[model samples]
Target: MLLAALIGAAGAVGAAPAAEPNTQVPAGSRHYAASGFPDRIVASPAQDAGSGFAVAWRTAPLAQPPLLELAVAGDSPDMGQVQQLRASSQALQTENGDSQHHRVLIDGLQADTLYAYRVQGQGSWSAWQHFRTAAAAGEPLTVLYFGDTQNKNLSHVSRVIRQGWQSAPDARLTLFAGDLVSGGDGEDDNEWGEWFAAGGWLLPGMAVAPAAGNHEYFEEFEDTPQERRVLGKHWPVTFALPSNGAAATASTTYWFDYQGLRVVVLDGTSALDLGTAKAQASWLEKVLEDSAQAWNIVVVHQPLYPLRAERDSSVLASEIRPVLQRHKVDLVLQGHDHTYGRRADDGASLPQYISSVAGPKQYRLSPQARATMKPTAEDTQLFQVLRLDDKGLRYEARTATGRLYDAFQISRDAQGGKRFSEVTEGRIPQRDCPRPVSPKGRDDRCWE
Candidate 1:
């Protein structure tokens, strides 16, 4: 069923059959409010970013058909010169009832140009928002990367995002390793609302590329809930991602080039399952071999090498590590352990693998983590800023309050190899917050 949904055959394969009509509905605010206006607006890079970009927004029923008006950013307000595009709208049933999801692709845009766009609701129009396109490859660029912001989306994670934005005001794009929300089934309309609330107005003008996490899959079947776990239904309809990936995992496992960097997003959860692992692996090798970009980065939810004490991702390490090493992938950004861990590749050109958490949830470090990874942190939420150019790459990880915890740089040689070095000279000491005590007033095994 999961594979079927990934390939857009959910209907034929049978979507998780509706069990019982949900009686308990959650409450949301602002964006989720049925105010007959467009909300939850977001921008994403198009497959051919040199001439295109995409936007998605939500509206209530009976609202005007979604319309987008766009023009090159200019001083004069020339309404006649602007172009309007109609978005494809789909009705999705949510905890807040039915709402329409609309997406529009603004193509034929010139590269490296600033453009202003606005969307229309039934009778209301959103204020204009602005976004810039990617400059050509080889040019210097800065991007922000985040880990699992699943829990406390509006309260805790929002601070990390706002802090990152304030720190890297010149960032061209944002990337999430996975788990953007705590709700996997997608029925938690309030959670998605909180996610948008957390981003506030920042996401509307930025191109965001996110990978899927295990939490993004909701078990929809009532008959055999344990066996059936497909992607949250809202995922396919919410974001307008590029459809150039593995046959079974297109939107969820695609690759795109931003300036000089090539980012490949993989469906790690699917790869753990035998049925889709081979296809994902084959597609990964092909994408890497065909790419000539200066920098190659891979983003996924699960780490190739697990960082927590109770977990071991032997399957991913054995199946995917060799290909990554062979291709000399520059960086691997991952999430899922609710901790911070960075491992410099041992005697390998692919020198950086970082697993970080960006939400409130924190886990105790595994005993083996001390031997495998350096500059590790527990009870810490982090966001990393990466700057890439012809010289090399610089990365810095900071806490929500804007305190540096880890930093590093990778120098690229003339022959395309990389030399890694730590740059954490004066960062905050590693956080090892004690586990919460139970009602019995005893130590939690997490500390053990």
Candidate 2:
């Protein structure tokens, strides 16, 4: 269902069922708002940043709109400086008895400076939240990347996100490849809470840029005759984002600059389902051409390089990779495949491919692809900590317990030649093993 148009600083939008308008009367089914509290905060400002940010939250039908406040820092031991920071407030409600809300864009923030804020509803505003603005051009910075954090999220999501931060305490930004939540389940209430609970305030701590995954694509199911997009009410209004650059009515697909890095965010669902493929492709190409940042990273939900047979149908592989190669995109971070993979296509003409999974699950790599990737260890829950340098880049894929699974380095020469090198000197155990024996079902001799 298309989330209803958000209104005012605190507005609630309704989710119109895909293919069918929700016929159920919005005024009746009064559960009486007696069960629990609806507290959520998601940040994604629409296009035209205008040096502004958008905020969204959820609440009970009968509850009063709380005092939503903004601040400069979060949970400071030095609360004495709260007055020194600037702030704002607002309120709202959705058509389906759901209380939706928004906050004023805490205006006039210093570029690349720290700001703290908070929310109030049930009783008082929650803890003070914090985030920073993008740095000026030509500055080098580090950003965290993750793919497929959907399954068994509550039990395992925190370990991976916090662990990544633990590894790089000062990472400038956080980017998610896709499938933030399992689509089939939690299509209704509790998922958003778990997402925020798992990561807690840490997600809002840094500038978060999440690519749209299949889970994020909720609206009328135009493809199927009897289907409609469901429960997508939480996406647009829950989060606050920079209103600078984006395409279309929604800012779910937008781009931002962080420390000389032009991080482009695109929605795979839009490219595949909507006829906006050409429009997005042209915009992406233009962004790449116009961007002079030292590093240009593109983050999306789908993978160009597939690890499983099911993942082979990548629309972007045909539609997007050509543009990336043409524009000299530095990195492409994506999810959907639940495995650990880092393959630099020595064969591809330009740029490099580094795909990974940071989840509680694990996947086995094929020994057949060893000609280039050389599959060594089998780890389901692994995160890559990549450090970009002028010379090239260094990547370390580690297990949740902090075990190093794969390590590789790429050094670029002045002539623009890239050198791929593997890590043989980590504290972790060595995986320099041979390929496993073939199964009885196939012939190993005449293979790919």
How close to the true structure is residue 216 of candidate 2, measured as C-alpha lDDT?
63
**Whole-model Cα lDDT per candidate?**
0.80, 0.57
List, residue by residue over 1-448, the lDDT tens digit for candidate 1.
8685775743445333222211123434233654578888988888766678889988887545678999888877764478989998888887677788899988788889999999988888898998999888867898999999887687678899999999999998899998887674444677777788888877889888999988777655647735765787667777888888899887588888788788889998778742566788789899999888889999988988788866767777877778788888989999988888988567753648899988876666777876788788887779999998867899999998889999888888888877878797879987875546312333322211
Q: For each candidate, what TM-score against the reference?
A: 0.88, 0.73
Q: Give stretches of model 2 more than 4 Å off.
A: 1-38, 42-56, 61-97, 101-104, 138-140, 218-231, 242-249, 361-379, 389-392, 410-424, 427-448
lDDT of 1: 0.80
| Native-to-model Cα distance after best TM-score fit, residue 30 in candidate 1, in Å | 9.9
Poorest stretch of ten by lDDT in candidate 2 = 16-25
TM-score of model 1 relative to the true fold? 0.88
Q: Provide the lowest-lDDT 10-residue window in model 1.
A: 16-25
Model 1: how far is 364 from its true place, Å? 1.3
Task: Give me the displacement of residue 177 in model 1, in angstroms.
Answer: 1.0
Q: Can you write out model 2's per-residue Cα lDDT over 267-349, one digit (the tens) per residue?
A: 76667666455667778888788876666788877667765434553577778888888887767887765555555445753
